[model samples]
Every structure is written in structure tokens, then in C-alpha cells.
Target: MVKFRNAAAAFKALNGLICVYKPACVPIQQIQHTILTNLCRDLNVLPDRPHEKRVEIVGPTNAPMTVKLVPNYADNPLVCGPRYIKEDFRCSWATHLGLFTSGVLLLGINQGTKLTYLINTARLTRAYKIHGQLGKATDTYFWNGKTVEKSTYGHVTREKIDKVVAHMQAAHQKTMFEMSGVHMESQTMFDLAAQGLIRPANNNLPVIYGIKCVYFNSPNITLEIQAINEYDKYLWTIIHDLGVQLKTSAHCTGVQCIRQGKFDLDIALLRKHWQLEYIIDNMDQCRRLMEEHSLILQPKSAILSV
Candidate 1:
């Protein structure tokens, strides 16, 4: 479940940014919608016009346009008429995860929304723990896809899997050929289920940092992968090319932003500073709080400049 902390005052004073832990089976857009809806409801945000019952006639209109207002404090709007309040406050993750995948999703809220471009290009590295089965190939080049090839793994051993991981981790920039349809380009990686035939002419290097087979017990294998790219398909393609027959589709079990930098997401550190009351309606106080919690990156400042 996506959790939302009240950062309205802090956001207005300092900058708005949020760290969301998106679980599997939930869309990123859905998480965004939930946050927006919850924040709106909590802040008592009303329609644009709360006081006016109707809009005055304009040049094209012959009669006044009646406005429908649902009073937040009204118990029976139809019987008691409309009621209005004067409280005014307003507040508003781009690293997309698949519906079946779960991981850390960074979001920029309110003024923080302006930092999307900078954060997206900040070269943040991500770590993922993926689980999948071995000994079969799916038609879609991933275990989640329909089964296309099946083979006996009686001869496959843990040693073989380790070698494959080492091969992938030690692979040089020149040896790694990008597979088409696995995210980019159009060359096929495994047309006839042969690894030798997968020679995609793409000359670009893979953005993968390293891959390690964490555990290999029979049909299930856990892989700890570190990559700079956004697409998880590339990891699947690399695993396939390394000769691991994927029986089950891979699911990211754990994700962490490891690199210590401006864009690295360390939510635990940020949560402590989410004290909205401390920075409530005070820009100077917010700046002081920000300085005190210097771990909160200054990307929000860069966003404000834009």
C-alpha cells in the first residue's frame, strides 16, 4: 500500500517530495491518484467557487449558470441548503514499475514536481532482487509470457548458474550486444532457442552494472541485479542469453537506492523530516529545517529555478 504523510505545510514552505514503496500488483498511476485524492480530502479542498451560488451571465450566455456546491460541513445539503468554509490550502514518482513488479518509486509533489526532469536525468542507480524459475523459455522472452520452449534441466547445476552470473557481471562493454524487442531495437535474441544465433547488431553497451546469482535451489533461482537502466526486460534478456531457461516470470522482491548521491533515494532519512508543523507556513523555518536535515537533497531548489 502507498502511504501518504502530511507534507502540505512543509511543501509550501520548503519543497515537496515523496518516497513511495509501491507493492506488486499496483500500478504507479494508481498510487499517484491515491496520494492526490487523500491529500485533497485531508486538506478540505473544495470546488473552485465555494461562496458563489451561480456564475454571472457572460456574453454568450442568456441565463446565469447555476453552480453545484457540496458543502463539506453540511449534513443534509438538500434540506439545510449549502454551507461554505474559508479554510484555504492546496497541495499536489516517475520511475515506473510494472503491475507485477514492486520497488521504490520516487515522486515529486507540489513544488517538488518541478524536479522531475532533473531527477530523471540524475543517473540514479537501482538494485533489485528478482526471483524466477529455471528450465523453460517463454514466448515473450520472459517467464510471465506464454511458454514457448521447454527443456530438461537434469544436467543443470548450481555451478553452471554461478558461471553464467559471473559471465554477465564480467562482460565488457564490447561483448554485450543489445537484444531488440527486449526494450530497444528490433533484432531478436533467441529466434530458434539458440544462444549463438542471438547476435543483435546493436553496438551500444548495456547499462547493467553487475548481476549475481544469490541463491539457486532446484527450479527457483534468486538474482541480485544492479543496473542503471529503467527497463527490467534488459535483465531478462541478459539472463536468457546466459543460458538460464526461465520457467517462471521474474518478480522484483526487493529494491534499494544504494549509490550515495543527490538523487539517491533514502526514504528513512526523509521520513524524520516530514514534520509538517515545524515548517508550517514559514519559509524561513522551512529553510532552517532543511539545513538541519541536509540529507534532503537540494534538487527541489533546482526545480524552483525552472
Candidate 2:
């Protein structure tokens, strides 16, 4: 789901700094200034001329980490800023400031993954005018909504930096990864606006959207792969239904070892999505993932996918 992409944990930490410190106006410029000047600096070194250089919050794969900029105010499109700093801002910064910072990170993206899937699935259900044109997963809702207090947070993570004082980590097993083939009813949106129908700005068209890395701490790539595979098949089924001629395939790589093991997964993914190239890269996150496994020496990246 789009919710859990927390491309980079920048927005989460930004929320923490805003709320805890209780800044003046809660204005965008003011918030940005506060985040850049105060919170970011205290956690890790701030980049010089941050506004000058393109600050992109990314994952291990260099993909834009989608973090929700939780509003101190304003709720138009329910917009959230993506890619403000490098990915895992929580892992990096939360190590210093503690749980509240971590919560900020989770609430934005990782935690939102489940809800995103739920809401989208619900939307597709009502919008399911075209039968057999979408994946079955889109029809199924995982939110048995029976709320238990235990279901409140995303996975707990640790900020294990190896440094004695920097050993805090967020156990991220709480987030859920999902694959959805919801036929987004955005044709009306596409029909409007300036640009012609070359590409839909809303991307409300039928898409086989898959959410990987929702639970970044999950050790098993096989499970995530299974989710992706299902999404891919769903896409294929839809393509077949529409009688569109398009070849399909799959590719992935990452540190393929354990934190206590020797090999690391160093891989990437790029595939033909109805002739359009779509990629989910955690090259950097993959690097960090490999780093942990590399504590055993012979880092995986050194061997492959560097």
C-alpha cells in the first residue's frame, strides 16, 4: 500500500521535533527551518545549504521513501512530503532522540501501510464495476478491524549502530506488506486538467501496485517476494482480461543473509509494467541491510550488486 512506503523517515522525525518543541507558527517554512536547524542537527550532522542541494529521502535502494508529513495544520489532499532526507531517518535519528521520534516515523508511513491497503480495497469494492479486470487481493480486506491494543504500533525497531550509546533500534516487524490490483477510478480525474491522456496524473488507471519493505525488519525476502509475485500475476491477469499484448517478468536482489550470518542480499528490481518501467529500489537500504549481515565479514555487496 502507498501508506507504508515511508520512503525516508524524515517526515516522522519532523513531526516529533514540531510537537515536542511546540514551534511558533506551524507554518511550512517555519517547520522546515525548525527541522533543518534544530531537530536534524541534534540527531545527525545537517547538510550545509540544505535548501540548495536536492534533499531526497531515500531507501536502501535509492527509491523515494514516502513519509507522511503529518500536518500541524492543513488537510487539503491530505498531502505528505516525500523524500526530504535519506531513508531510515528513524533508524538514524531515533537512535538519538528516543521513542517519540520513532513514533513520528512510524505514524507517517510504515504504520499507515495497513490502513492504506484497507481504504484502497474498500474503494475498489464499491468501484468494482468491471469484474475479472482486477486481482482477487483487491477484493479481500485484511482489516478484521477488531482492534486490540497490541495492534496499535508498527513493528518495534532498534537503532543498533554498533556504537555503545547508539545501540537503539526500531523493531520493524509490525508493518504489513500487501499487493493490490485496485482499479483506481481516476479516469474522471484524468479526463480533467491540462495534460492530455498521455499519462494520468492521478494514476487512477488499473495498476498492479505492490508494497514491499513495509516491514523493513522482516528477515525473509521469500515472503516479500511472494507478495510481489502475487501482484505481478494479478497484473498479468488484468492485462490478459483487457487483451493487451505485453511481456512480463520479475527481478530482485538484496543482502541474502542473516544479521548473525555471512551473506548479505545485494539486489535491485526493474520490470516492464505494461511497457512502462517501474522500479522499487532500496539500493542504499540494501546496502545498510547488507551492512548488518556483514558484521560477519565478507560483506555481500562486495561480492555482488554493489
Candidate 3:
């Protein structure tokens, strides 16, 4: 768990909740701040937290898992509207952090054929070390029953986006943003995030434009969450089985790449202090890894230093 020493820093907190599956509540003060702080550092991004709330979920087996909800105000939702009808527009979480991946579903993007929003199987929460405090990541950035800055205008139709544009103009006091199509030529998590239906936040209130802070909004959108409720059960069973086998003994081992190898790293320290794995990839990443392990990191690339 990370601690935000400065108690005054701000972060996203809309449909946010700290879920505790059991009767006991998790000591969220540190973990919450840690998630936020580490995420910020990795992506070099910053965000503000709003009001705080906690939710409790109980498992039939009496086990509990606290899923904290935190908001993340995105300047980009991976899609721009109006004039961007020709090109691809997108707002991807992993790309900003420079994560190497594929088959991503962005929160929003223009597919040329259609505009989709996918709240899929992926982690959608980020915390930061604001002003030096390690904040925990509250990851409820999904379109689940969580709250959001939305309006109940119509069903999931083209008109739905039209009203959102109007509200955004009035809310932000300008046409501050837009969406179009997407970039890159692979399946990515960024685009999968924007394939969902948008309805009015409320049914009785016709004028109640649902506008909840997107960050810390509700259910943290992640790849795992997507498969649970939306995708086919059979598909998930097969995929999960396959995924588990591929993760371990993967390409990270130095045996496969030769240039990259497992290090006798102070693994606990990496997880504890930096929230990162200390896999010795190259001389650059392993400089600190070697120093910590009292070992020297040699270059797999034998290019002589000119």
C-alpha cells in the first residue's frame, strides 16, 4: 500500500467506491495512494481526486475483495467528433504509459465503420505521487452502474452523442474537445473501451443531464471485467485457460531472448518500493537492478563503445 503524505492532493473521485467483500475493511489509506502515485509516475500523468466513498461486496464464501473506485479525468477519451470523421481518433490508456500490447479496446475511438466504446477486460485506474505522496489507484473507470457526468437524452443512438457534445460545450464552457477515428494498425485495449451503450443517467428527470466525473466513476474498466459480464462464457473459459499458460515462462526469461535474462534481483524491493518488477532486460534498465543486487549488468548487444 502507498501513502500520500500530503493530505491535500486531489485525484479523480466520481462513481468511486472502496469495495470490501468481507466485513473487514481494507486499510485503504496506503494502497489507495500507492496505486494512484505509481500509475502517475509510470505514465507521467497527473489527476485530481474528488469526493471519496467506499462500497462493500460480500462473497457467498465469506471472502472479500476491496475494489476501490477512483476517477481519472481524461483530456482524451480516444475519440473526437464532428470534423474527425475521416481519420482515426482515440484515447488509449496503455499507449500513453508506453505499454507494449495489442488487441486493446480504447475507451472511445472511431472505427471508420462505427464508433464504439468498450469497457472491457483491462485495468482502468491510475494513481500518482502528487507533490511526492504515493497515492493508491482507485480503478472504477467503467460504464457500470457507477455514476458519471451523463444525460438521459435517448437510447444508444447517434443522437446520444449529439447531446453529449452540447452538454460538454455548456459544462466546459467551450467546444474544448472532439473525437474522430483511431490510429495504429493493430487490435488494442484503447479501442475496446469505447463499445457500449449510453443512456440518460436518470429516467424520471428529463432535463437531468447526467454528468459524473469520468475518473473514479464506477467499475474500473479492465480486460478481466469485460469477459465476466459481456463476452461468452465458453469463450472466457478457453481464453482464461490459454492466457494462464502463456503468462508464465514467457519471453521475459533471458533464455528466450538471450539479451534479456532473469536477474537475482531484490524482487521484494521492486514490488515494495517501486511497484515494478526488476527483470534485467538491458544495461539501461538493469543499472539500478545490478546496483541493488551487487551485480554488474553487461550489454547483450556487443556493439563496442566507440
Candidate maximizing lDDT: 1
Model 1 lDDT per residue over 129-246, tens place: 6776666766655656777766666666788778767766766322443323342233342332233222223222335556888887866667777655446565556546655432
Error of 2 at 256 (Å): 29
TM-score for candidate 1, please give it: 0.56
What TM-score should be assigned to candidate 2? 0.16
Model 3 residue 10 lDDT score: 17
TM-score for each prediction? 0.56, 0.16, 0.15
Tell how far residue 30 is off in model 2, in angstroms: 33
- Candidate with maximal TM-score: 1
Better of 1 and 2 by TM-score: 1
**Predicted structure 3: lDDT:** 0.22
C-alpha lDDT score of every prediction, in listed order: 0.48, 0.22, 0.22
lDDT of each residue in 99-157, candidate 2, tens digit only: 11111111112332342333223222110011111111222111122222221112222
* Positional deviation of residue 168's Cα in model 3 after best superposition, in angstroms: 2.6
| Candidate structures ordered by TM-score, highest first | 1, 2, 3
Q: What is candidate 3's TM-score against the reference?
A: 0.15
Q: lDDT at 259 for candidate 3? A: 11
Task: Give the residue spans of candidate 2 off by over 4 A.
Answer: 1-114, 117-231, 238-306
